[model samples]
Structures are given as structure tokens and as C-alpha cells.
Target chain A: MATITTTRDGVPRAASQPTRGRPDRGFGTIGGYIGRTVLALFFAFPIIFMFASSLKPDNQIFADLSSLRAFLPVGDISMDNYKAVFDTVPAWRFLANSIGVSLLTVVLGVLVNSLAAFALSRMRWRGRGFVLAAIIATLVVPFETFALPLLWWVNKLPWLVMQNGQPMWTLGWLDSYQVQIIPFIANAFSIYLYYSYFSTIPKELDEAARIDGASWFRIYRSIIMPLAGPATATVAILTFLPAWNQFLWPLMAVQSENLRPVMVGVQYFFQLDVAWGPMMAYASLITIPVLALFLSFQRAFIGSIASSGVKG
Target chain B: MSRFMIERRGTAVLAGVATAALALSACGVASTSSGGSAGELTLWTHNAGNPAELGVINQIVADYNASQSKYTVKLQAFPQESYNDAVVAAATAKKLPCVLDADAPTVPNWAYAGYLTPLDLPQDLVSKQLKSTLGNYQGKLYSIGMYDAALGLFARKSALEAAGVRIATVDNPWTAQEFADALAKIKADGKYQYAFDLGTGDSGTEWWTYGYSPFLQSFGGDLIDRNGYKTAGGVLNGDAALKWASWFQGLVKNGYTPAKSSTDAFADFVNGKSAMVWSGIWHSGNLSKLGADGIVMPPPDFGNGPKIGGGSWQWAVSSTCGEKAAAMDYITFSLNKKYLAEMAEKQNVIPATEEAAAMVDGWQPGGAKRFFLDESAKYAMIRPPTPGYPFLTTTFAKAAQDIIAGGDPKTILDQAVSDIDADLKANNHYGF
Candidate 1:
């Protein structure tokens, strides 16, 4: 076993490590900071520009494009665009709809996909390998290729609805919240992610739980699921982003203004004139929840990615 | 351990039973059909974000509903950008509303796809509307608009006078050489960033087809042979099209117009950044800011006469509409002169009928906006009214972009022609 030593900086260093191979402390650290800052700015400029331009009028947004002023709230700025956004579309309703849809998708997706994955990863099943392979194969197919066919299929599906205070059934899920959420819940990539993560968990925990009179589900629920923090966070984030940014599916599926999500609201500004200010304001408005979500789950999300070897 | 195994097996059995019960319950629910109930007629409009236009549509619906005791119209507004997609999806699901508004160019395609039904309105009412406003495919009138849009070259009179360029009129618009000289003189004056704004910053395929294809038509080349509507063979890749492509590419090379303009080209021209802007009549409202200096001129004739793409959004009755007569009644009632004028005034488009135009303030005879009406009457050429127009427009827009990007005119046009021909052949000439 390798021994660890505490350096003057309070960082643990391996006893077998050579100091010569380490990077220089002063210039290298400063250079790294500079490079990181440049990369950060490169990634952040578009968002900053969107936020800043949302405050400015249309012409000024174009006029400042040649200068650094484009990314700064400097000239003729106001909350007019935000006010216009409200008047143009029911922004709050769309935001709320998106929040509800994304949360339900994440929660339900976590349950269904994790259950499927748990069965594949832990249970001794006759066709588990083939099942996993089929699920993984679906990941290679794009959503757009089958979007129309899915739309047709969903229209043929029956749903239970409340009518006149009584439960009744309705054909076709178009222009409804369930149309947006239910179809997207059983994501293949999400199941695969959970499968990979669940496989890493020790089988001893399951055996111990079984000996203690726990059922298979109890083992999955009490042992495996409790330890799936990073995987859950990863799946939640991945599922949430697509649900929040659903444009085509919702556009095709839902028609009622009351059922529209924030992403579809972006189209409200693309009128004959293309209201750039209100559009940017709406974009900035919608991007906040996603940013908050990512920031909140940043650590767990990164851990999941690193451990599971998923690049995205 | 035996008790533990038995207990685990019992739990699994219970879980399976519960799931089966849930599935059975789900499958046992009574099913009902979708879409509007008996007398409720649904109307969809591409005016969700456009409050002014949407207000007019809502008012029409309200009046129509109040005017009838037999039927009630319910309005659903969608954003214009995604309106077509929504309609297409709804059509695919067989859930299209009773009445809907479709862009003029798409009427033929929709009609051919059996999405729309021919109108049953009186011949007098149909004939009263401008020819371009009537969305006729073959001989059947499928849709009609309350107003139409026309394109014009908006210029500042002071800039034109300073550049020594003759003011172009509908009757005697500038020739190809004269237009080129005007661009050169304006560029030499150095008073603006570019001599003309073609509104190229708009990245939509429809804009490219509507805004630029007329230039090709003026150069004596068409997207397809209007005679048969079967192929783009010689018409799109011929010598005339080659000339049009080269001249269009030259506009960017000569720095006469920005290859990619700002999103609002008229705004740039208004801000003194350009000498002129080629845009639709929608921008006519802001031309008043230029005071007496503003001039809306006809497009220059390039060998052929000046041509502009015609038509605007029009109302149609869906084929799936259970109440076609009621839908048509609502449509016809909404085309009143008062509503048309109101739409023209609020939306700043040319009223579709002469009587309607006479009611609008600026569209009357000798009115400031009469030029657009005159231009539309004389020069507007409707895009080929065919089921294959969607593919044709997209193909033409792509080819135009490639030409503007310095691709060889002959190669790009030929390839475009081949692609269009292949599509036409594949669609069996789209029931021509």
C-alpha cells in the first residue's frame, strides 16, 4: 500500500511521487487561471449577450454588436422587453407548465427507468441480456425519425380523463399535458445509465438484505436505490433538460395556449418583425431554471459522468 | 432462509398482481372521440403573438358566433413560425379544426394533401376579392384572404436625387442597366453602408423564396415551367437563370448589398445605414418617419417586367370539418369590407378588395400607400400554384443561398434543377 504525505500546502501527496514531474507552482498556476478564464468567457459570452441585449432596444442590440458593449447593459436599457414578453405570451403560465412537465418527467422517469435497469442489472432473468441490448439499440435511433409515427400512435392511444366530475376515457392525447410527459418517460439512454451505475453496486448488499427477509424490490429500494445518488442526479438532469427544452414534440403534440411550455413560447416573438428584445428576454427567462438546476446538481452530475464514462 | 425465500416470492407475486390490476383498469376505460363536439366549430389562426391581427380574428369569431344561433366558433391562435408544423401534425392525427388560416403559398400543397376543402361562397364575393388574394389550386378556390402583401423598393428621395438615379414608377421601372448604375452611383456616394438591403438576414426559407425568387423571375427564369408544372428542367438551369444567379451573386461581390443583412433591413435603411431596402408593404407604416423623403418604388425590370411574389395568409375550411357550411358562412361573413379595412389599417397590408381598399385610409386612390396597391395589381405573380410548391420553394431557397455564397451558378442551378425534377417525378407530377 502507498503511503500519503501532507505537503506544505495541506494537499495529500503520494510518497512515491516525484516532485520533478509536477508542474511549476507560480507561472503554471497563473497560466492555467488565464486559460480557464478565457475558456469560461468563450462559453459564457452568448448567455451574457442575451441577458444584456434583452435590456436594450432592437436597434441598439445590432449597433453594439461590433463592440464589447454588446455584452454590457450600457445604453438605453429598461425592463420594457420583459414587460412586453408578459403582454405577448402568458409567460408565467408557460414557465409553470414547463416546470410541472419537467418535474413529472424526471420523477416518473427515475422510477420507471430505474426499475427496468434494476431488473436487468440485479435480477436473474431468462432474456435480460437481450432486453438490455434492445434498449441500448434504441439509443442509436433519433427521436425525429419516429416523431411523426409516435404522434400517430399517441393519437390512437386511450387516456382516462375526468369529465363532468366522472372518470371517462378519451382517445388521442393531443393538446394535453400527459401527451407531453407520458411519452417521454421511458427513455432508453436513462435506463442504460442507471443500469451501468447499478451494476457497480455490490451484490453482497442484496444477499445480506435477502437473508434479512427483504424481497428483491426491498433490496433495490433499500440498498441499491439509496446508494444511487449520482446516477439519479445524472438521469434527473438529463431528463429535465430535454423536457424543459421540448420544442418540436410539444409544438406537434399540444395546441392549447394553456398547455404550452416555455420553449414553445419562444416562437411567440418570431412575428413579422421578429421582436429581438422580447425574444432575448424570453430566452433569458427560460434559461434561468435550467441554469439553477445544473448549478444545484453540478457536483453529483459531474461525478456520475466521470464514474460512468459518459462524456455528455 | 426458507421463510425468507417464501416471503420474497409472495411479495413478487403481490407486486405482479397489482401491476396487472393497474394495467387492466387502464385498458377498461370507456373511449370517446376527439375534436369539437356537435355544434362547436373550431378555428385556428397563425396570429398568437400578433395581438393586432389576432384581435381582428377574435372579433370576427365573436361577431360570427353572435350572428348565428345554429353554430358557435371557437378560436385557437398559434405562433406563425410553428403554425404550419402544428397544422401538419394535427392533419396527420386527423384532428384538424373546422376552420384554419393557411399561408397563401401553402394552400395548393394543403389542398392537394386533402387537408382543405373548396369554398362554397358566392361567386360575387369570391370575384370581389383581388385575384392574388384567392388561393386557387387548379380551378377550385380553396382559400381567400382579407388582405394581400406586395413588395417594393423603399428608398429615400434625397438619396436618389443625390445619386442622380431616376425615380422608378410602376409603368416605367428601371431597366437592368439603369438599376446597376443606380447601385453604383449610390455606392460611390458613400452615404450609406450598402446601396440596398435585400433583407437577406431573414434566415427563413419562405422569406428567401418570396423575397428573392421574383428577381430570378424578372431575369426571365422561373422555379418551374408554369406551362406543365411538371419539371424545373430547362427553366431553372437555363441561360437566363444563370444570368440571374451571376447578377445576384455580383450584388454581394460588388458590396452593393450585405451578403447577410441585419434581421430588420428596413430598420437599417431607416437609420441611414442603407440607401434603399427591398421589403414587403408591412414596413409601410414606418416609412412616414422619412417624411417627404420616403419613396416606395417599383422593382427594376431585369429583361422581363418587374415581378413580385403575391398572396398572404388566407382562411380555409378543413376537409375534416363536420360543419363545412357553417365554417364557410363564418368565413364569408368575416370578409366584410369593414373587417377587411380594419385588418388593412391594423396590419398595414393592402386590403384584398377594391371596396375594402377604398375604406382604408392610406390604401385609397391618391393615398400615400396607393403605390403598393397599384404594384400588386399590376406586377404581383403568384408562386406556382401546385402541390409541389413546398419542395420547390425550399430547393430554390437553398440554391439561391449557395449562389450568394459564391458557388458556381451553373453547377448549383443544375443541381437544384435535377433535385426538383427528381422530386416532381417521384410525386408523379403531384396530380398535375
Candidate 2:
């Protein structure tokens, strides 16, 4: 066994380490690897089962539930369910709508929320604390309590439309893409997240920029935003998820199938005889994109959570 | 950080917001309308994902639009699961389409809430429809359906024969005792995972009432007293209902059925996991996979004779529809025997009229699907035609779920009755 020694910094150091060519194979490290692998598998089993079941027939899916075959694509498998998904719903159209809506919401949300956060955190203004408190307070009011009233309000709003090559005003925001994206752009939780992260940046940076005759917007755009990558990533993901998974609002607000998102498409398979296989296929199809997005932003998401003291 | 750079950035931000606003404004489609231009009538149906039914509906609209120059009918389809929420939301916004299809039990509530208008189709044409297909609340017809559905006990002939269970018929359904014996015999065979699949895995409250309430009614209990529609006190918690609660729970306790079966019980039955499945008419198509071995039997006569939940999706004109006469004209035109037969054939539901049934392949007299029509005509019991049905259904479903999960049936039933009565009283007996 290599002896461990304390360094001047009070950190443990392996004084006489094992051969440099090979890594340590200690039991603790091995146990840690086992634990991590188990945790990864525990979280991955549902996704694995979903993907596996999506390729099999409905009867075969039930038949394999008793054993490990459920999570493995080992039985008679095919892309038939995926094909059926296209037949059952306009899968590509719904996917495209969701992606566009989610991306736009993320971009707009980050810009709008970060600006609100910067004003609350860096700029000196009267009633700033009350404004921030009010924004945070709205988080406690459940979306469902105001969903109906919001629906009524959106239906009465006026929109600009083109008729016969002339601009005309129309009433109601029903059956539109903007109705889905705009209402979700100014999220309260996102504003709070950006505020917390912005508060951590040293005030001296803003002071130095100000001493050099920088405007507030200039300071926000140049100095503050560049250092808010983690916060931006966190807010982008937070906004994207709800935007992608919107079902009830879109179902009520949007009447056209072409305007619907992927989440609303899931209901298409819930016919009299629910197409379970096709539903799983649609789920897997929609989930893969979100999984990829989260994976790409995994590091920054965790860093933001840690640095900003956000629980999740 | 200079003044010019700051001004440029500010200008860019303002320009970006303006562009985004313009883009968003341009994204809006023409607002949905019940009646537009005095000649266009908008109709909505809950058939978005169902191509077969939607195809027929689209064909009807196309034919109607082609057959007339005065008005054009436009169809918008929504998925069935969330269709109600959409309609309710639209109703709240006072933007309901000219015509929409609503589930049967909801027609009363919709009419009571002033969401539906009394249909103005020809009385002679309406008389030809199945009585259960008519949505009548407070002595006025508010809706009509092209097709209705039925329920049956689907099983394999081979399994029944091997288990020595006598095949049941519409005339002489198995009594409660005989049905219990059959389940016991099937379980004793030990060849299947469960002797019966009650489809309890369907967690929808509507399913609970539609699929199981018939058994409660057969046991001489009901969700509410029909005479007054004011309360569920005696009927829902009475002795007959107690017996139903016990027997329903007993099926699971006796291991005749899983407490919570697979989500797709018909799939499990088709895979030989369950010897029998209590399912709806929608599942009859999949029975063809069993070839001649598959059989459908009437539900057992628990005590009040065999019963099945009735009523299905029915069409109605929204109260806010500006073109009520025009919408009624289109609705009446679509009710022709030709369209009805097409719906019955393509959707595999029981035709709403004998004349329509005569036109369909398997729905004519002595046809393979004729039994479903006979069952619907004889044994079908439409849920209480009262505006309180929504609340009643939810209460009964919760009570039934609790009983299935092994709660004391009497306590749960009593609580359900109390809750239901309180709601009825609160709403002034739902305008009785």
C-alpha cells in the first residue's frame, strides 16, 4: 500500500504512489465505479425500455416484461412502430414546431430575463428589492389557477394580419405559434436564476466599466453577458423544457394541427385501441433531442447550479 | 464602452424587438370563427389522429360544400383525449365553433351550461336513429350521434371449452353465481396468468364509470336516483350498491383478475396472458386475430339483468354559433344513411339506425356484427341523463377505485354518496 502524507495545504498526497504506468485499483475506487454505474443504469433503464419496446410488437412487449429482454432490443424488432407514428401523427411537422418554439423561447428568455436580472442586481434604482420580491412571489401561484383567465385574455388580444396584400388588424391570438412562445418568454423562475447568478459577479467589474464611461446596457452586453455562460445555459434549458413539453395550453389555444408541438402529438395515438408501440416510438423520438440538448449542456448546467446555490 | 457604441447597441436591441414583434404578429393565422363571412361554417371534431373517421368527416364536409353555393363547411379535428378541455376553453373564451362533437354524457352538462343549442334536424329523420344515440336533456334534444358503442366479455372459444365453461348468449347471459363459477373454473385450469382482465389499468375516470358502472347497475345500484336527479344517497350507498362493491372487490381478492391489469388488457388477452377480457366494441377488430376461436359474450346478469354503458360521441351546434340554421342544414345533410353506413363500416362502431346498419357489410341482419347492434338496442342503458353526470361519474370512479384497492366498500360508497349529494345540493340540484 502507498503511504498517504499531508501537504502544507492540509490535503492528502500519495507520497509513494503505485507504478506510474497503471492507475490505482483500490477497493474504494472500484466501489465508487460500481456505485456510479449502478446509478447511471437505474436512471437509464426507463429510456432503454422505452427505446426497446418501441421496436417490438405490442404483444411481444408484454411478453418480455418478465425478464431482462424488456430493456434489450433482442426480440423481433423493427422500425414499424416509427413508421406507424408518422401515419398516426404529423411527427415531422410537430417535431419541427416544437424545436422552433423551444429555440426561440430559449433565446428570447435568456435576453429578456438576464436584462431584468442585471437591473435588479447591478443598477441602483428605487423599489428594486420590491420588484424582485414581486417577481419571485409570482412563482408560488400555480399556473393552473390563472390558466383559464390567461386563455380568455389571449383570445381577446388583437393581431396584425395581411389580407389581400393589405395590412389589417385581427382579434384573438388563437391558433398561432406566437401564442405558444410569447407568454412563456418572461419566466419568473428564470429571472430569479439569472438574478442569483448575476449577484455573484464582483461589483468592481461594473465600477471599472462605469469609470471608463460605459452605459448600463453596454456594461450588460460586454462585461456581464460574457461571464454569464453558465447562467445562460441554465436558463436556456429551463425555458426549452416547458416550451417543448407544452400540451394543455397548446391544445386549448391552437386549433390547427400544423401549429401543434410534439407533446400534443402524443394524444393522437390514444385512440380507442391505443397504439402503445407507436406511442413509445413517438416518445423516444421526442425525448432523444431533449436528452442530447441536456447532455451538451451538462457541465454548464451543473456548474450554474452549484455556483448559484440553486437546488436543482 | 463608448457613447456611439452604446447608442448603436441600443438601436440594435430596439430593432431586434421590433423585428421579433413583427415576425410573431405575422405568425398568427386567421382567427378561428364559428361563422365567418356569413357563408362559412366551422365545425370541429375529435378525430384528429383517427384517419378513418376523420376521412369520412372530411368527405362529408367536401360533399356538403360541393353540393351547395350558399355556405362552405370547414372541419377542424382535435385529438380525443384533450378534446373536452379544448371545447371548455373555447366556451370560456366565447369562441366556440359553429358545430362540435361532444361525448354523450357531456351533452346534458353542455346544454345546461348553455354551450349547446337544441338541434333542429327533421323529426322524421331523428326518429330513425337509435334512442340511445339522441342527447336529450330537460326534454329537448341537444345532440345526435352517427354511431354508438357496446361492451362485451371477449374470450377464446378454446379456453372456455377447456375450462368447461358454458358459452353465454345475449338471451341467457351467465348469472352472477354462474359467472363466479366460470372464473373459478378458469383459474383452476392454471394455464393463464389471470382468469379475467377487468382493464383496471386504465386510469381515466371516464373509463372507470363507463366500464364498471354497468356492473354496478346490474347489481341493482346506480350512480344517482333518476327520478329527481337531486342526490345519490340511497341508490349509490344502499344495500344493492354494497353487494356490488363486495363483488367487484371480490374479483380481485379471489385472484380471478389482477387488481391492476396491463394498460392494454386486450393485448394481454390476445397474447394468452388472460383467459377473458372485459372490453368495449372498439376492440372487436383485434379479435379477428384469433380467427374462429375468438368469441364475445354478454356481460353477466349480476341481479338486475345484463347491462352495458351506452351513448357515444354525438354532434351538436354550439349555443354561440351564428349560423345555427346553416349548421343544422349541414348536420341534417350528413345524417343520411350513406354517411352513417360509411361511419359504421370504417369506424367499426354500431350504426345509429337500422337503415344505416342495413347498408354496412357486417352490420346487416344475421351479419357477424349484428349482435352488437342487438345488444345496444336491448341491453344498453344510457348513463343518467342529468347535468350532474360529470360530478357523479368522477365520484363513482373514485369510490370504485378505492373499493378495488381493498378499502371497506361500505365506507367508500357512503363517502362517495355523501360527496355527490353535497355537490348536487351545492349546485341547486344542477337545475333540476
The global C-alpha lDDT for each of the candidates, from Candidate 1 onward, is 0.90, 0.90
**A-chain TM-score of every model:** 0.92, 0.91
lDDT of 1 at A207: 77
Predicted candidate 2 versus true structure: per-residue lDDT over A26-61, tens digit per residue:
998899899999999999999999999999988889
Candidate 1 DockQ vs. native: 0.54
Per-residue accuracy of model 1 over B183-202 as CA lDDT, tens digit each: 99999999999999888998
What is the Cα-based lDDT of residue A110 in candidate 2? 93
| lDDT of residue B114 for candidate 1 | 94
User: Which stretches of model 2 miss by more than 4 angstroms?
Assistant: A1-25, B1-37
- For model 2, residues B1-432, the per-residue Cα lDDT tens digits are 467997999999999999987876665455456545478888999988899999999999999999999999988899999999999988898878898999999999999999999998899999999988999999999999999999999998888999998999888899998899989989999999899999999999999999999999999999999988988988999999999999999999999899998888999999899999999999999999899999999999988999999999999999989889999999999999999999999999999999999998989878999989998888999999888899999999999999999999999999999999999999999899
RMSD, each candidate, Å? 3.7, 5.5
Give one digit per residue, the lDDT tens place, for model 1 in A157-208: 8777776766666788888999999999999999999998888666766877
